[model samples]
Target: MQKRPNKISRSRRKNSAQTIFTRFMLIVAFFILWIGGIGVRLVHLQINQHEWLAEQAQDQRRNQVKSKQLRGTIYDRTERALAMSVQAKSLFADPAEIEDVEGTAKKVAAVLKLKPSDVFNQLTKAKVENKRFVYLARKLDEDAAEKINDALKNTDLRKFDEPRFAGLHWKEEQKRSYPQKTLAAQVVGFSNAEDVGSAGIEQSQEGLLHGAVIKKWQDRDRLGRVYDETELEEDERELPKDVVLTISNSIQYKTEQALEAGVKASNAKSGMAIVLDPKTGEILAMANYPTFDPNRFNEVAPESLTNRAVQSMYSPGSVFKLITYAAALQENMIKPDGEIDCRKGFIEVGGHRFNDPHATKVMSYGDAFAVSSNYAAIKTALGLGKDRFYNYALEFGFGSPTGIELPAEARGQIRPPGTWFGDSLASMSIGYELNVTALQAASAYA
Candidate 1:
């Protein structure tokens, strides 16, 4: 039995040695394949996705922001500031860094006077989505922003060692402000919350007034605190050009007061008045009734923001009679002291009768003009004929824009002599068929 056992033991030992060797070889092959797969994955990550991964990582700790340069200041002829850009703070938050979303929302709502529930919901959504930037309020007033900053300082988690609102920050921004408020509001126009001009001169001169856009990159800590800021290299920055208007602040104020009073007393819907320097053709004052404050332009009707002095077109009425009388006198068609019969207050033309509010049997040309007698004007214009009258009107700068540096200036409606109807001369003489703007009227009188 001992001799037989010896032989079996030797065979079993040999079989065991072969089984261990096979297992070692299989393990070595499996490991080699595993290492090759890992190497391939590393190559793909380093080569293919390097830029995207780097950007992803950088975006977490850095932000690129656009900052608007200060808009040019608008001044009156005397160099008094009308519209200007003021430095202000715009509040924002990094939602991912906001540890207490509800608490932060409440604090922001209280400071900004916003709806708490709305702010809370927005903050919650942003946090859940891991948003990095969210604007809470823009262009806050100095007093309000100072109060918010004070509150933040007092409740700072790092400074006060208390659980406080985090991820709250502010950026510098330019806010368009009209220190004169309603003064020259229509002429100066207004810029909206986004610093875009909406009306009047502000819109017409936007290209010159708007400053260059500045771009910057800012580095932030894990808590979203901006620690460093660097301006990115760009093309030359153009400083905004200041606009110097010929408007007189004193005259504009007085004119507005007078116009407002006149409109209210006359029970009129709206009114406009323009005063010009006769020698220089410079506009001294332009005033509109029911004018709005440019600061609160968004709260008013768009129609109310219209600069009626240049934008509105209307019949010149008796005002146009000066042109007819001048044309008649200039052509020697009628003497300065000549008398014309009113036909007892009415006259007929093309089956239409034109009446005179203040009429007499016979009156001097000067008397006719003084009383604004429609019959006398029409009679004088008829003597000048159609061609002469139209030419005179064109010479007076009617039927065309005055070329003032303002937006939406109406050229007015002037039909050609060929388009005139049978009674067109009579109608035009009394200023019924012709249209003109207030600025045109002022220029003509000048």
Candidate 2:
């Protein structure tokens, strides 16, 4: 009976141990399954999340800028169009969408008057697989652009059933034009490809020239057809205001004719002439040698862009006598009949001999000026002293800008009285040793 009890006890213990072992194994298996599931989840997060996350990141990075497309028109005094933008077609393409690049490029180039090989290379070289858009040309005329659109309509280049190019990217941009051509080539100036003024009135009035250009975001389809977003605000196109100038065409033409003749006759490198109405400060005429036609400005040399009238300086020759005479009269240092001797046609001042083109035995201040007697003028200037002469020169607008609306006008020099050493006073009296612009001389006379 004792042996039977022990055997039963051992059997019960064995069964209990087996049950615990099975439970332990099951718990371990469940732990393994949980760990495997967690690892698979981690892999999915690391690998598969990037594409969706990257797309989200790109969406966040996308920004829209409201670009403006506004421009101003330039007009003459008569309200004629000198420069303005016109509606034109800007040609573009999707190279990857292009099936027959060579054939299409040939047709496009023929219509555009561009080289076929060049066009083919440009279109094909953008990308071999996935480029969406590339520009071929801008500002095509209506006729050529229409023909291109017609061809695109009938072609098999489109990915969808609709026309491929979406009827050419026709948009209006400002184009510079000089209607009168060379009438005021240097004055009106020219605009570059970007419609920015480079010089002349165009440069001075750039802010007025480029008004504004507003652009709104547009949604594009798979075929690249564009439509304005519903939420986009409307902005009216504001035309640029016209500028009235002090320049006149009639006198400008006459001056140009006279200047061309003078430039040829002088056998000089170049020449310029500017005629201003002194009473009103209006520029009646401004002309230069080797002038260019603003309409065909690209054909001209870069040097022709300069306006020589305001930019040049000369000695002013005998014309400066008026300044000396004016100084003497204004200072009351010499009357019109004031006596001065020039028998030997020379006078010694500061140990320097000054002579005149004409000999004056003895002449009055009036005769001295009438004949441009250099010696008599020198004596008179020396008597008037340096301070009065220099002061008068400054008053007449020497060594200063003429306040003309042109760029780069020269400021002629009048040496200060303190700097007038040795024979400078004597030489300056005869219009030597001092530099003056023609504009200054004319102002002095006026």
Candidate 3:
């Protein structure tokens, strides 16, 4: 009995030791896993998520503001301002800083002719969303802005003192003005709200007209209040250069009036007219019907904004015969007094019959050209052959843009010799299949 009791005590002691050893191993494993998890989290935060956390922290205490300089003025040859930028005011607010949103909205609405309830809603929404800056009005007139400024300053007055607008502020902005209204609108083009030119000379000379952009950094306090606004000076800042066009405003007006009258009298859909100084290749005037005022360009159709003189392509008709006759004369294939058989007033070539409106028989080359006889021109072009005619067309600036300082100028279509159809020569002789811009035709005549 003593031996059996000793055996049982030894077995209980072994089991107790085994249980303790298992618990110790489990605790050690758990501690190692916990340390590993902490190390991995530290590595992710320090390396992978470092930039993202840093940006979030920086964004809390810094803000960027953009200040725009005035865009350059566009002047005519007489130094008359066609387009200019005038100093104006843009109203903005910091919703977080506003004390009484309703009062401020009502006051601003009264001055800006806006709906008070709408303004109030916008202000309240911005505040709820924690927006720092919100625009109330952009590019207000100087006089109107001054009135608002005066109202804001008169805080001691009975009406002004009760509902004070705390965060309303005005910043200097530029508004583009066209002094002459619709005069030379297409030639001068128009700039958008950001002072970027959209067409005409404005677009072609965008580099010279666009001004330097000023960047400013503002610091904020712990409460998110902005302070210490600083402008960073850039070495590349350059004052915008003005563009002086060769267009004459007076002549442009006269031409525009005449074209308008003519189109109205004839009941035409639309018309275009261009005046140029042959001696200097200067465009004195370019006029198009259905014009729009640059000041109100946003309200007009896109088609009305096009400069038709350089943009539209049409068959030159009789105008192109000058080139053909000149080519024939230059090539010694026909003389000024050379006679061509035009008694029939019509001729057939490449299975196409071309008819002349003039009812003349045999006549001199000069007479044929004077009457614009299609038969004479076709015969002359045929005699000159396709190669010489094509070469002369290229030399006369056909089938290409005139390289004018205008946007969207069309390079009139001219098919190569290989692409020419069997009746191409006959059709092209009197300007049937060919296309040319008005500027190109004028340049050719010059």
Candidate 4:
């Protein structure tokens, strides 16, 4: 019976052959479909979106021409440049290209006058995917930048000591330089790392000073010699226009001297003075004690960096007598020689006794001013009436900025006439209650 089974299964053998062939054909069809899908995707990426993808790839490596505007120069009345830009180089590195971050940072530190940690941090900040370069240090001297460029040569261990390892590729960027450290720092102002002005005349005339820089498509060879091929429009490289100031450097120096002496003598926290050409509105000299140098402005105290003569308002103390006396005389309430019998230097107004710091008896208006008698001045102001007196103070330019070309000018305050009663009127008359700026006092005197 077993011998008969060997010859009886021919149909079964045929069915088995068909099943194997069907599976083989199905596997071949699946492979063909997979290959066809891959080909279609390759065509879509290489041809359908080819231009846009090529542009994106080119943006990552191709040399791009960027126009850099040169910032304007500032000059004193003497036509000497108070502020100007000088060429400086910013150092950059490609972290992916750096073989040893720690060692490279040390070499950069040696050349750039920077900390090793700082350079390392800056180098590491470059995005691994998007960044081909990153700035290591900005505004470095050419000599230092050269030293760094040289240091990048040699192997990781030998580069610092070797002379030639510094030739690694890095991009150079332009930096703005200020020669004078802090002279006229508040007035001349400063530029950001990008060379944009933040304050003062630098801010006021920023448009005029920043000149046009022309950029055109350039061709480069293996030698990296960039040459312009096409007449890509006239990129006129207009230098920044110069700004002339009304300030006199010599007079400014003298005023600084005077202000320092006065500040020391008064033992005050801070002080300022401004001298103006009474005829013209030009500020002859504006001085603030404890001024900061413009060159290293970030190192100075923010308070000291302010031009107090323009930005501060003080009580004006005895200096305000000039305004009070002028108002009284103009209103015909008191003559220059008018006598006030301020016996014992005490006057009762609304139950408040107004007295001078040092007492005086009867005095003329001129003598009252010369002595700064608070009682006599109050008497004059009371006689003049608050309405007329307040108007006169306003007319004299108190409670207003002088409209000078400066930053942060403050307008001093005078209480409204409606708030003026006996005490306030008397207090204001003696220069005790009123707030006035140095500029306002000078203007009233002028």
Highest-scoring model, TM-score? 1
lDDT of 1 at 436: 96
Candidate 1 matches the true fold with a TM-score of 0.81
lDDT of 3 at 327: 96
List the candidate 1 regions with Cα displacement exceeding 4 Å.
1-64, 125-131, 153-164, 217-230
How high is the lDDT of residue 219 in model 1?
A: 87
- Give one clash count per candidate, in the order shown: 0, 8, 1, 13
| Cand. 2 TM to true fold | 0.72
The list of candidate 2 runs beyond 4 A from truth reads 1-105, 116-144, 147-154, 159-171, 217-239, 335-340, 350-352, 361-367, 418-421
Instruction: Give per-residue CA lDDT, model 1, range 1-446, as digits (tens).
Output: 35445888899999999999999999998999999999998899899999989999889989898988899999999999999998988888878877777777787787778998999898888878878778887888788777777766644266221123467777779899899999988999998878888787888999999988999998888765778999988778787989999999999999999999999999999999999999999999999988999988879887788899999999999999998998888898888689988858888898899877687668899989998999999888888889999999999999889999898899988798999999999999988888899999899889
lDDT of 3: 0.86
Point out the higher-scoring one by lDDT: 3 or 4.
3
Write down the RMSD of candidate 4 (Cα, Å): 8.9
lDDT of each: 0.87, 0.72, 0.86, 0.73
lDDT of 3 by residue, 146-225 (tens): 77777666454333221234777676789989998999888899988777999888888899998898899888887445
Rank order (by TM-score, best first):
1, 3, 4, 2
Tell me how candidate 1 scores on lDDT. 0.87
Any residue pairs clashing in model 2, and if so which? 67-214, 67-215, 68-213, 68-214, 69-213, 69-214, 70-212, 70-213
